[model samples]
Target: MTLNQMFDFTPVYIYIVAAVQLFIGFSLSFAIGQILPLRIREFMYYLFSFLFLFIPFLYEIATANVQSGMRSFLFYLALLITIFLFTKESFLKKLSLFFILIFFDGILEIVICSLYWKGICEKLFGLHYTPYINVPNQKVSTILIFFLPVALAEIAFNFLFPLLWKRYIRFIHLTTFVEMILLPVLCTNGFLIFLPELFGMTGWILLFFILFVLSLLFLHAVTQIPVI
Candidate 1:
């Protein structure tokens, strides 16, 4: 076994996945957004905000360690709760956002696995990859290159096609729910379930409020701008 594999890299790998969540979730910087106006058409507005503002700095402070994963994982739960609470977006936009979220949240996990295959594992971050955390087995080699780009494609789909398509929101959300639940299983140690733990007793409630506020901001902005 390699040094990292022998040492148990799962938790840190989880952290890397978490970092990607923050990145894709936020998709930050207002000025840069002008260049890619279509990005805001989907929930990618949030995704881009999270990614642009915090990821690189976060990458610098944290390790390709498990704590990093916890940061990513914990932060995203906060974000999801925010979304669930706020905004009057149609089910179709919500479903489209769900599709984009597939990669935005999962990429952290996928990237760590890719780095490992490339023999540069430690540089990747997240919950299961810390010195004390667990190492996920299985090399998702093919998934690495394609995953993010596909996420980008999903974003593009929502961006370019603002009108709702033939599919229904219920169907897509249910499918997304399956994928979300499945990720922790296929990933090691199943730590994502513990998200609210990091936030304390009222975490869910707080998340709801934040979502409410953000949704208002998004709606207000969308109504004012010519885009939506």
Candidate 2:
């Protein structure tokens, strides 16, 4: 195949998704500001947030590998590390929370994207084509297929997470919050990795929607947990 055939031009929707990622990145920083004890200037906080979000995309472009799994993982890691640099929190505490949140988010991203690609994008949108037409690995194809849907989820979570943080902000302890988030992450990852194919397309759709609802519920429930 020719070089043209080897490249998969991203769709317009995916470009929109990139813009959403920027917003989500900003939202993450904003959320951290609300929770972290640091007192950064508003303007600088927004600037660093945008930097954390946009740099990964630049890295992807520089490498010409949009389906990079490690890059996606590293993006969040780097974002948290940068945040760590600015915060006054104990380094171990900050770093531990960073890893926890990143792991939770990564697992959540994978599950949601898998369900969307296997169910909605394929069955509804008729996007039957491989994720990376020219790319060879099935894992890469899987990552690429789910990237946009995950972006959409990230955008929604960006807004919703902060809202939960605001409402339940006084109630939940930090340790409890992390534990609450971990439950769904573990369950969803297990289902997707081991028993994913058990769900037919319709089943996947239902599962995805159920998980979406549960995510909101989980956030609300965590915030309502009283600090003993």
Candidate 3:
């Protein structure tokens, strides 16, 4: 097949792969959640929360499609706001935890992208690559290389954060939670979405640096919030 023809099918293939992954991930997580003890089941709820909220953005970032990435981020933001409004739980505390999850997810995205772009593809398959340009040459390998790390990272963070929160931060205050969610949304829109449109890859790198620093601040603030 000609290069253009091969590239043309990339999006369709990506969507199919992503759909399958999501189905399997959700099914397994739900099944496991069903069997766990009640306290541990709450942690499983945290896992479900990340899967529901962040997977769209995860797939978009893996594909390196900025337009779709923007849409996914906006979709995630909308879902978060909706959950905050409708849920019976303490909205502020839950929203704060969700944003913290987002910050870590963003950090993971940066790491995955860095590893992929810098040397992973070259070392693994001896091909210089971006998500789009050279995919047709190594389609399955490329997709698996990107997808596996992301999936594994999601599982790791989903498990780890709940434990950390239970141990270190049992609750967050209303004011701190407000700042936690608000600033990240503003910074994410600017760095991940808008600036990338204006400045291209430079803007993408800036997202990593700025969000990493912001995440540190987020962690610090969460730790400092007086535990109720």
Best by TM-score: 2
Model 1 lDDT per residue over 1-228, tens place? 653364363333344444443444443122123322342355665554454435433542354443443554545444444444443465545433543344333554455445553444333432233332333542333223323443453344333332332234334434334334333332332334333555765765754564566455445544544532
Rank by TM-score, highest first. Answer: 2, 3, 1
Model 2 residue 29 lDDT score: 66
As a TM-score, model 1 comes out at: 0.32
Better model by TM-score: candidate 2 vs candidate 3? 2
Structural RMSD, model 2: 10.6
RMSD of each: 12.8, 10.6, 8.1
> What is candidate 2's TM-score against the reference?
0.55
Which model scores highest in lDDT?
2
Worst 10 residues of 1 by lDDT: 28-37
> In candidate 2, residue 118 scores what lDDT?
75
Residue-wise lDDT of candidate 2 within 72-131, one digit each (tens)? Answer: 544565567557756667775564455354454566677786787778878986676464
RMSD to the native, candidate 3?
A: 8.1
Judge candidate 3 against the unseen true structure and give its global Cα lDDT, from 0 to 1. 0.53
lDDT of each: 0.41, 0.56, 0.53
77-133 per-residue lDDT for model 3 (tens digits): 544643444344565555655555556556665677678656666787776645542
